[model samples]
Target: MIAWMMLAQAALLGLLGAGVTVAGIAKVRMNDWILGAAAIATLTLVVQIVASIIAPFTGSGPTGDPFEYWVYLVMAVLIPPAVALWALIDKGRWGVVALGVALMSVGVMVYRMHQIWFVQVF
Candidate 1:
């Protein structure tokens, strides 16, 4: 895993979480800005997933268990879209909270992914 890429993902994901949470607290619902942020974060995550998959073939991979890494990545890719859909359907403050939680989960998962990539076993 590239250091810069890992950091960028974490930062962007963190921003996504913060943005969604703030929107929730303010009782805002679906909007172009919210959708755009989610799109960017989701696109980045999909790109990262592809990169990780190819990394192994390119003689690069996580030091930790591959199965665990892939499972997390796949779930991360799925979550944002799911929550976004739910937000669109609900169209309320609770939907915003759900989006915030989903984005935060993605942020935490991305951090864990970086840890998995760089683990040092004795």
Candidate 2:
């Protein structure tokens, strides 16, 4: 749970969410951008997971409770891909809606990751 990485993820998710919202509102089905964002989010999540795995052994063990962090990580890694795949298959505005939800979820997960790493409360 690197602080900088979490922050970066948060920023990316925030931007993605905003983009999705705007595109949805404008009734513009920008599948390319949505797909690109999903791909980037997945990559970022993978990097974060790898970093978390190596953190403990690299002398930065247990920044907070592992259980809490794992919950956030798992959700962050799973939700976007599921939504993206669903969106690709569902040929309607529902796809955009699903992508929008996924982007927002990623933003929330970023915050949860930050809390798990830095807040030291939950």
Candidate 3:
């Protein structure tokens, strides 16, 4: 990932994380605002697809096994939509918690993917 991509990913993680955490803590139902977050996350995943395709040429690509990075990528791509779908199916505080968990999980996954991408450097 490049600098902008990293920053964007971090922003998404923070957005999703904070949004979910607050909603979960406040016991709010799944709402349109959060669905907007999911849409942006989907857009991010689209960016990820483009980034992965070009990363190797830029020499900013993963230095370790690309597979590891890809696995995290898959999860990162899946998370928001999956959580939204699940929350829709099971609505409650638990649903909000599920969103929170998913967002937090994305944070961890992104960090791990960063490690996987740069492992050979450090």
TM-scores, all candidates, are 0.92, 0.88, 0.86
Residue-level lDDT tens digits of model 2 in 6-110: 788888887887787667667767478878888888888889889889988877766667888888888888988888888788856768777877887888887
Q: State which candidate, 1 or 3, has the greater lDDT.
A: 1
Clashes of each: 0, 0, 0
Best by lDDT: 1
Look at candidate 3 and tell me the lDDT of residue 30: 79
In candidate 2, residue 37 scores what lDDT?
85
Model 1 residue 38 CA deviation (Å) reads 1.6
Winner by lDDT between candidate 2 and candidate 1: 1
